[model samples]
Target: MGRNTRKRRTPLATKIVAGAAALAVGGGGLVWANFYASAHEEHGGHNRTRSAAAQVATIDCPDVGQQIRDVPDRARGEVDGELATMDSQITDAYQRLATTRRAQAGDAQFVGNSILGPLKERRKVIIDRIQLEINRAGGRADDNLDELAGCQGRPADQMQNGGGQNGDGGDQNGGDGQNGGGGQNDDGQNGGGQNQDDNGNGVAGPVADDFIDINDVQPNSRNSRNGLAANGDGGSTGTFTTECGVNENNLFNSDNLIAAPGVDNGAHHTHDYVGNQDNDAFSSDQDLAAADTSCQNQGDKSTYYWPVLRLQDGTQEFDAGDQGGGAEGNIGKILKPAQAEIKFVGSRQGDVVAMPKFLRVITGDAKSFTNGDANANSSWSCSGFEDRQVTDKYPLCPEGSQVLRTINFQSCWDGQNIDSANHRDHMAFVQEDGSCANGFQAVPQLQIRLAYDIPAPTVENGQVQNPYAVDSFPEQLHKPITDHNDFINVMDEDLMNEVVDCINRGEDCQ
Candidate 1:
């Protein structure tokens, strides 16, 4: 199975255009050959397993431009509701824990590590409620494509029709076995039959007989990527062999192997674009798993139960109980809207806070009172404050109406800072475009109040009096970044390649 072939076959581009079925006539076995080759060897030395998303993605298809508008069209609205619930719940839980640990502000700890226990526990209680819609959006489409793969390409179907897998016993690329006579290279794709290079690598050759049939691709790409051609029924199942092959540069490397069918699509979504860490639910990549690295008790932990949204009106949305949103529950229609983000708790110095990525938008969805202790704040009191402040000065409201705050850029961080540090105080507001809206007397503070309460983990002597870095709070943070990025490189490459393969195959993918 590891035998790398330098055999010549057909041009892939031509085969794709001709249709998935055209290649299956005698190509079904070729598909299997590939599958069999990679069954072992670290996915048999290949990288990632192609997801249905890659198989169905259409990159430069002529018809893509024609149907651009109607694209998946599934509104992200429902997902927002779900996000809001998850964001705030986690925040509140953290705050609850943060209060008890208020004593230890000097110990270093990670925001992510603190929440691991709580988040996992909460997820167990009601994962369906919080992540249902988002997960559905992310994984359901992929699942459908798998089903389609089974029915579309492979000699399995030919065998059912009384035809043997061995079309005509020939060399690995000469043809299938049986029926012998060194077949005619059918569609004239080979122009002459399977050709081999001096090094025994199949570079430019005729397309293998197997290709996804037109009927294989799901008519509704959204209904699940179930493509008939993807399924190895009578379609071609060629052998997948990875051996030395050089790129256009002509720099040959013997170990440069040929990957398995759909392998690139699965593991290399970003090979040619992205990366993965699905089990954690919060982790999409290694760097994921919302964290606050500078908090006292510097452990790699996350403490929030579930990230949720808290409205200015005191109303809140969380996911920890019965999880059943379907298409319109926690996510579908939140009778009311709540601001949201992946919440964090526990501080080192001041009261200001920062959120990961684009979370500020969720928190600023609706405005309210400043100084009212986020837990004590209500959605209603936050009413007109959608544009107000949250710190000591410069609030949008008249004097005493509420506290004014700001989100100033940090000299040490990349995103807007909201940590209870020396520079920026509390975040004033969240702008519509994912920017902090803390109107101010100075530069706009770039921090975000992304959490309600996050309890600091454990402490040695005792809880540090202040966690925020005020003159009183000292920076005790110390530890190495445990989550290394290297582990995900292969996975990332696999995901990207999957996307590219889908495009080349002319499937409707993201």
Candidate 2:
């Protein structure tokens, strides 16, 4: 054996194979034993499982670059509707103030009234509100907008960990959890939605079921009519009318007539209603389809009463624009102080000028003009040879001149009337006789009708109750015109421009 020791040893390759086989069998037996023990332990009221820490694997190669890209851009914006409403209100206030100063000359029914009026009080309130809005806008002017998802600084849906993002972000197993680890946060939540970036603007929410078309709105209206839906659309029982007293027979002939903003048919009366002032002008346009143009048949009255329409660019302005009933041959236009300025002209005594005195301007009454009629009495003028004075007859324009249908009551001759000596006063009748019970009295402008013509009151014992001055005119008007004693005049370029700016900006100026 010693002589052949190398040969006697087992072959090297053969020995290695035998050892591998034995090792495999031994490992298999151990694995089986372990499985059996675990199963038996569970059945015997004893169990062991991997810890949560053991289950969660460390996310390697987390793709940090792609994860960062998941964030949204900065988001925020302002709500335009609220801004517009406020702007309109502000503009209205400016216009009202200017109108009051000019129309009412800043005077009042009495001293107390001058201090407290709708325009004055409302204007103050609007100013305060505008200031608050401006301050709020300042905070959001430069904030990151991409994040804001709702009105104010709120988000549409809030995320765990105080951010708008949610889900266990790339925590483990490539789960659906985007941007974070999965599972709801253990703490209570505010449900605040998402945080808005800078600029009060946020992600838009779903609009309400009701919305209106703005283009279809009439001028001076907050209401809209377009986009209305009904159970059906086809035939309807409806009627419409305009300020000029339109009828169904004239539907075809009426110009500028259009569909009304809406129709509100009552049980007894069926008619169309316009929400806006400008839209109201077209109320009867549809109804006029059955009629013919009759303005041409009325002589020179075919044209406008004031010739104020646009005709400069080779435009055609004809009698067809007489839907307003030819302005009733008595136009009454009111321009607020913001639109036009009024100045007084006085007489001159020597080199120095002497201002004339006017009591107050009268307006709103139906003034008539009878231009071309002849009557008795002869002072023998070459044209008609009659003693008729200008005032006695409806005043006429000069020969071949057009009569002015509307006149702005700018200045005044005080509250006095020329009733020949025995003629009872006519100016005072409107105020005293109570004729205008249902009538509109030009409530927009500062106004005055004649003093009441009732018989002089009898004062008993110590005092007369009316407290009105006997001479009729008050001391306030007796002095020459000035800011304190005159009407508040706001008609100027600056004020008008301000109003226009606010309106264009879509602010709540009202």
Candidate 3:
């Protein structure tokens, strides 16, 4: 299990079709219809009552990070720590809920009384600490934060019914419900309650309904004008492709520097990291700038990471018995991506600006399962069937077609700050008319195209044989909708300017 010695798999050639908009000049301006709006929210918020014997699928807690928008810079560290503590509290409560199924079976209110109630109490204490720290730093704290302390127990059906779903599912920081909505089975996939057992998979989620055949899916893709004109021309038409190795170095960690900086296991799930070699919760900007990179060009030392994908074939990996791994219900063997393509394109509206060094950008919501798809920007599709993209369910790729995970980062910047209080406000996606809002400048948009040579899991009889899922917070239930990616721009100044220049001039550069 040496870091660089992991077995490498060859990838088959696959066309690239990602994000809300198609790449204008880098790859051909291939149009794409997205699945952010209606596909996943079909059964969400129907308010069906669960039977008394219904099983609680997972613990549903308010996203504390989403609610706190005014944390002072001086108090961000402590508030972040408290938020990390609340996440750990939820993880602990979820573990208790998952393991004590028998006890829950006997007591009708067992989940509410033992798991959710205790979780809420702990969250209240952490919420108080967050508000206190903010106020101590001379910032006005939200007086109604106590409302976010209460947690709920969602049954499998409720989870299947995702809450507060909206069109486009691209609200980066704009969902209101504590438990937004649940997964659905609109395509005749399994939508029943959880199994009494773990269904032979050590993890708690990704039930049969979590997957659908790509061929069975209708072509719901539409051409999006991400920053491009309706004719798919004009604007910054160039692209800069960076050759970052598919994290063959086994650079993995559970800490999230952007959200829960300085906290151990902040993500509560392992992430596959490429680009920057020295990344952790405690890594400073100085540390990242001096770190070695996995990219072919030493000047482009940006950090790119995402939750590790695992195949549930009963193979125990390195973190199997550790926290953020099997202990938190993320089991199975981690799968390395067959190909990792990192490309940066310009805005279609006008010339693009260089991203400031050390700028942090996060795309897709890791908590999309409970937070709703308002901010769900990631998409899943098969190699050949690129026209069919799914936001909620994993694609059951046909034979010879690879599984692809596509993510397009927020392309518009607020111009003033490199980081925002919510880690999202500083960045925005392009509007429908392919223009950035007032005061926001268009920046080079990073798009990730990752392909995996995974064996399509056999789904039949409401059971999965070898399911593959992304690492996620335990409560997120390993749903495909919860898949997300993270990035920190550590590129040197010269290379970044070159990226901007090449993009503005409409030339493809590497």
Compare the candidates by TM-score and give the number of the best one: 3
Whose lDDT is greatest here?
3
lDDT by residue for model 2 over 242-343, one digit each (tens)?
Answer: 111111121211111111011110000011111111111123323222233222221111101111211011111221112211111101121111111111
Candidate 3 per-residue lDDT, tens place, 1-510, comes to: 333212212231111111122112211221111111111222331211222223456666667687678878998877877878877777776666555544544555555666666666777788888889999999999997877776665654344234332212321111222321222211112222133224455456666667778876668662322212211378889999999998888888777889888776778888999999888777789888999999999998899999989987777677765566666667778999999999998876889888999899987888877776656776889998887887777888888999999888888898988888778889888887667897899889888989999998875444567889999987787888778888999989999999999999999999
The deviation in Å at residue 35 for candidate 1 is 58
Positional deviation of 210 in candidate 3, in angstroms?
Answer: 0.7
Model 2 lDDT, residue 43, Cα: 14
TM-score on alpha carbons, each prediction: 0.16, 0.14, 0.83
lDDT comparison, 2 vs 3, better candidate: 3
Model 3 residue 182 lDDT score: 21
What lDDT does the true structure give each of the candidates?
0.19, 0.17, 0.70
TM-score between candidate 3 and the true structure: 0.83
Off by over 4 Å in 1: 1-78, 102-117, 120-510
Error of 3 at 383 (Å): 0.6
